[model samples]
Target chain A: GAGVSQSPRYKVAKRGQDVALRCDPISGHVSLFWYQQALGQGPEFLTYFQNEAQLDKSGLPSDRFFAERPEGSVSTLKIQRTQQEDSAVYLCASSLGDGSSTDTQYFGPGTRLTVL
Target chain B: DQQVKQNSPSLSVQEGRISILNCDYTNSMFDYFLWYKKYPAEGPTFLISISSIKDKNEDGRFTVFLNKSAKHLSLHIVPSQPGDSAVYFCAASRNQFYFGTGTSLTVIP
Candidate 1:
């Protein structure tokens, strides 16, 4: 079975430009999550989705960031007016069911976004 | 504020020796602790995990120990192999999971 996967292994964006990163969760996974990892740092949570409904988004940095999982399988994280600070690897993860303390999350390769 | 912290940025050990990675968290609400291993150009993979109720959990050569009193956890790898060299991340979860800065481990053969 294919694991979770993200598109555009690397993306270089100019400051103030908008960029969208996509993630494809594993088959039958019902819980999806997004995270940001800076150079030499750990991944920070961004948002979470259970099926088509977004359950938590408190991790999003600002209004410029938006995420959607409309069909409950594919998800997108869009950043508007990119800043140099936004440069990092965006990671996507999914679990077999609504992620609980018992479920383990499988991660994707991640899309590295570099804002110039 | 960083809730989870992995103080050691890097570590090196001789092959066949034990490697211990430590992590601490400030949030007392975190009940679940997880360890993830990552290699270059790849995403992190789940290694092992422990809940607050249990003090230890072991799988194969990997063992995770949790100390609720100290808000600390550690991952121990026995007879570390070259293939085990990679970045190890510690994560704590309450309602959501928080990750540490990560520790890079190198095994010298």
Candidate 2:
């Protein structure tokens, strides 16, 4: 079975531009998560979704960031007025069970966003 | 305020030797711990995990040990192979997950 997948393996954007990254979760996965990985650092949680409902979003850095999982399978993370600090790799993960810590998360290849 | 910390930025070990990676967390509420391995240009892959109730969990050549009192955890890989060289990340979770800075492991073949 195909694992979680993210679109645009690499994206270079100018500062102040808006960018949207997409994620496709595994088939039938009930839980989806988004993370941001800065250079040489671990991934930081961005937001989480259980089916079509967003359960947790406290990890989002600021108001410029917004995420949605409308159909419960596909998700999008949009960043408005990107800053140089926003340059990082955006990772997506999915799990079979509910959005619990006990469930193992399978990750995608990630989309690297570079803000100039 | 980094809750999870992996002090060692990098490590090198010979192939067929044991590799130990350590992690410490400040939050005691973290009950679930996980290890992830990542290769260049790829997302992290889940390795193993342990619950606070259990002190240790083993799968194949990989073992994860958790010390609830110290708020620390470690991942051990026996007979490390060249293919095992990558960045290892330790994560702690209560409701949401918090990850460490990650340690890069180099296996010399």
TM-score against truth, every candidate: 0.99, 0.98
State the lDDT of candidate 2 residue by residue for B27-60, as single tens digits: 9888899999999988899999998899999999
TM-score of 2: 0.98
- Cα error, residue B91 of model 1, in Å, equals 0.3
Candidate 1 per-residue C-alpha lDDT over B1-109 given as tens digits, one digit per residue, 9 for 90 to 100: 9999999999999999999999999998888999999999999999999988999999999999999899889999998999999999999988788999999999999
User: Residue pairs in steric clash, candidate 1?
Assistant: none
User: What are the candidates' interface root-mean-square deviations?
Assistant: 0.7, 0.6
Off by over 4 Å in 2: none
lDDT of each: 0.96, 0.95
TM-score of chain B of 1: 0.98
**lDDT score for candidate 2 against the true structure:** 0.95
Q: Which ten residues in a row have the lowest lDDT in candidate 2 chain A?
A: A1-10
Interface RMSD of 2: 0.6
RMSD, one per candidate, in order: 0.7, 0.8
